[model samples]
Target: MSTPHCLRSSWHAAPANGGRRENGRVNDFDPTAYLPDDLLERIRERAPRHDRENTFPEADLDELRDAGYLAILVPAELGGAGLGLAEASALQQRLAGAAPATALAINMHLVWTGVAKVLSDRGVDALRFVQEGAVAGDVFGFGISEAGNDLVLFGSGTDAAPQADGGYAFTGTKIFTSLAPVWTQLGLHGLDTTSPDGPKMVYAFVPRSEESAGRIVTRDDWDTLGMRGTQSRTTELHCAVAPPERVARRIDPGPNPDPLVFGIFSVFELLLASVYTGIARRALDLAVAAAAKRTSKRTGKPYSQDPDIRWRIAGMALAYDALPPQLDALARDVDGLADHGTRWFSLLSGMKHRAVTAAKTIVDDAVLVAGGSSYFASNELGRLYRDVLAGLFHPSDPESAHSTVATAWLGPLED
Candidate 1:
């Protein structure tokens, strides 16, 4: 009945999620304004409709901007709260605890924060695009995933061919461009072949409205079964990319060698686990609540009185409390990330694999406990069940993440 002590930390509330700092680092953040109870309530009110129509939660988007969550990842010195990915991951878990749609939609804003980290100072224009979204009351989501692309690799069929003025023109398709429909500003994360310097995978932060037409960036509609409210659309960015000076890293067509950036992958994995954890928690909550009232047809006993049902409930609760120490350990290690090696990648990946898998098990237990109630659309647990099922395949399939982590751990010793 009470909130978990691990999550009851002073952080994970407003502005503590990932607010940026004044100089654009975490030190510059103001966490108080961002994590009020009111914002969570606002997000919940829109979940059902957002799911039913498969539309972006525009109202909630407005609320997020007003709360300054768009810059939550920015440091306090940078005129934003400087919440790091570790904190953001926790924030996401809490948000997902309330509504998967809300958490999923907010990812776009977070990835833009990724661009901010990757770019450092070279991304002034990109940073402006993100800030402008805050000003305009919209959050930018990325269109990076393609349906056919393997989950393990950063695959892109889209290309940014050269333009005469020194900027490259991006052409080709990108899928699962989540948050594009609601984002006023957009960025297509891809490899551009036309850079004045050389080929590279750079983020092109451009506008989404008709005003940016001849300048490039187009969107195609998307409809999906789970996280339907995210509006993950297809986008065609057939426009000039940022000049070399305005861009971040040039495209690495092959695997990135640097392990520090691997932390981003860990952050993503943690965020998804957070989302799945929240969904599983809600599902279990509903199941436990429903079990109290529903009587079994066979024995005319309350569902809660059934031995099997009680066991399932206990299992789900165990999962909810199981992984915090692991996740928290990962969070603390982030402060000393500069000292991390390949071992960091292995540990983080393993943690993600474990946490997500546990969340999946909780979902299974939730469905078994709820029985028929989980099948109804009106039931939040039902929506959550679908969302949890989707998580098993999210980011990378469970098999790949496991193998990848396992190989990372053993590959060095053998070599």
Candidate 2:
């Protein structure tokens, strides 16, 4: 499908800042080289429009696809950049700075690709097809989050009824499904209590095709307080079938030690943290710029000279600087196969929780530094204030992270 007319205009209107490559390939495996300042500026220009219109950043997606971003984690042998999680996390942080919603929506796709990369690095070839599919321009969406299933990946309310052919039919509603309008495959999990294995959780990819007629429905109800451009809508799966070939993994439910689970949690939480960290970085930058530009009546000088503004900006910077290095270290650990064991979960969840909380706090301080002008809905800081709230709603929430940490420190509560 072609990009919308509004996005097309914005694309053409953007100055030719030499961001596009002459060969149309991003093989360097470096985000700094791939996502240049000019490209980010173009994306930043389109972000407000998408947010205001409550639509997906189709233009940004088109540009990113052209630049081979979708296949960043795919192996170089598979015609991709062959970058690792550390690099991917850095790239996500940069992307989020330009447009948080766009970066977030695309995070769903990257999660699958990152997991495939993680598994492949660990000598698991199960998800090789995911890398291949992404190289072939197939967009993957995450469909694991379900309403009222606070158990997270430990349990599923969706039914995974086994088929005679060894596949399974999934019937359940998936909430907050990002890239609903354009996803070609959805990675989801459901419980199969009737299975001979005695209650297995089936993780599979359901293809979008004519065969899914009336079986898959994407709702048009994504109006929200912020991150409106994500267009994460509710998806109804009425007996959505996953052929045997698409079935990725099947394991006993309820927190068994599974690599698939670890892959998902680690990549999801780290990448999610990366995005919010980027948002915080952007908020800090904006606050700095605003303070340097706005003159104060009392001092007849830039607010940046004011001790209060300087202190707030310094605080924001201090909070922001700590995240990227932490993200880098953990991502490197995953890439290096450093065995953290169960502590990996606590570390991942804690990093995500801290990143989101810090990002929100930084944005709040940013708006204060930006003054009353940022209170307007059109102001980027105002929009960021809203977007940061969505961080609290993601998995491994504040309560969950704290519980995990507490359990790690003191062990699980008495039965």
Candidate 3:
């Protein structure tokens, strides 16, 4: 599939900007060089099948692992591509353009590695094992979201009780646990109210092993409206334990300035934005292609020549063009350790909000531009329309993003 003209101009313009210096030389990074068109086409071909079956994309994962896509954020010395968040964002956009479910599922793994990269770059080695594990081909799953847990990262519904061995045993349920079947390690957080220091948020990693037997129960209930290949099942933890070495952090509950908090927030929000932006890019391309091919019954000419079709496509392009630069700039800031202080939360959430809303708008317009044929489930635009809705459910949702930005500007409602 050809990329939309507007996207190709900005997306691939920075080919050498996000690579790491290796052996006293900098490696030039181009997302297509890593993803390649053929690999993406294969993933795309499997996407509809996985979505139809509502099953996890196992083949897609194997192919991605073979392509070294799992370790994109790991250092080259650790046998990875040694790319930064900027590069990772670009790669995700490309991958999502082909297979959103595959890209979204993989985004969870990338989030852990991205967080590790963010923290390690700032001299904190608490998550160095994550980077090494990624290079060693161990998939890390994100186990954070909980039903009705609005505190999200600031607090948790799960319990993290301290053990005598300096470990912590987590007991609770984690919803939307992506990579449910394949993750070798799960990164999660829980509340530890029994600690001497009062209620603290405990961040840790639990490996999938005999120790986790009967402790971790993955419920086979991932039926969803779209992005079915993610298989983000609900995980029930019955005293799942994280060894001392796996306990990465402990911070006070409800909004803390800890580096781990910043790292998680930055990587998660930016990566989520990248994925949705990719959906928008794909929708825009489909609309453009549809317009050029379909003839207008009234005018006896291609829809692309119709003023109304042109206007709609132009609006989609205008919205789509704003996201790449924003993603690149914020991702580069994180990589460069450019601190925005408390403003970082607002900025990250706002970007995510804009990307998701714009994606939905673009997809809605694309559906209109593609005409009646796109209404069928078999059409790619139809699939994209459903897939794009998942964006509204991700972190920094419309309500949260608005509240965050409001507080950032209006000073917390005089509370």
TM-score of each: 0.80, 0.92, 0.93
Which stretches in model 3 have alpha-carbon errors above 4 Å?
1-28
Q: Which candidate is the best by lDDT?
A: 3
What lDDT would each prediction earn against the true structure? 0.61, 0.86, 0.87
Model 2, 42-127: lDDT tens digits are 99999999999999998888888888899988888898877778888999999999999999998999999999876766666789
List residue ranges in candidate 2 displaced over 4 A.
1-29
The candidate, 1 or 2, that scores higher on TM-score is 2
Candidate scoring better on TM-score of 1 and 3: 3
Give the alpha carbon lDDT tens digit for every residue of 275-383 in model 1: 7666766777777887897899999999899998998898888877877656655654542233344455456556666766787777777777878767889777777
- Report the lDDT tens digits of candidate 3 across residue range 1-415: 0000111112112213444342111256666778989999999999999988999989989989988999999888778878888888988999999999889999999999999887767667789899999988999999999998888888899999999999999999999999999999999999999978978899999999987999999999999989899999999999999999999999887766677877787899889899999999999999999999999889899999999999999999999999999998899888876656556778889999999999999999999999999989989988998999999888878888888777777766653
lDDT of model 2 at residue 325?
Answer: 90
Q: Which candidate is the best by TM-score?
A: 3
What's the true lDDT of residue 110 in model 1? 76
- RMSD of each candidate? 7.5, 10.0, 6.8
Which stretch of 10 consecutive residues in model 1 shows the poorest summed lDDT? Answer: 1-10
Q: How well does candidate 1 score on lDDT at residue 255? A: 52
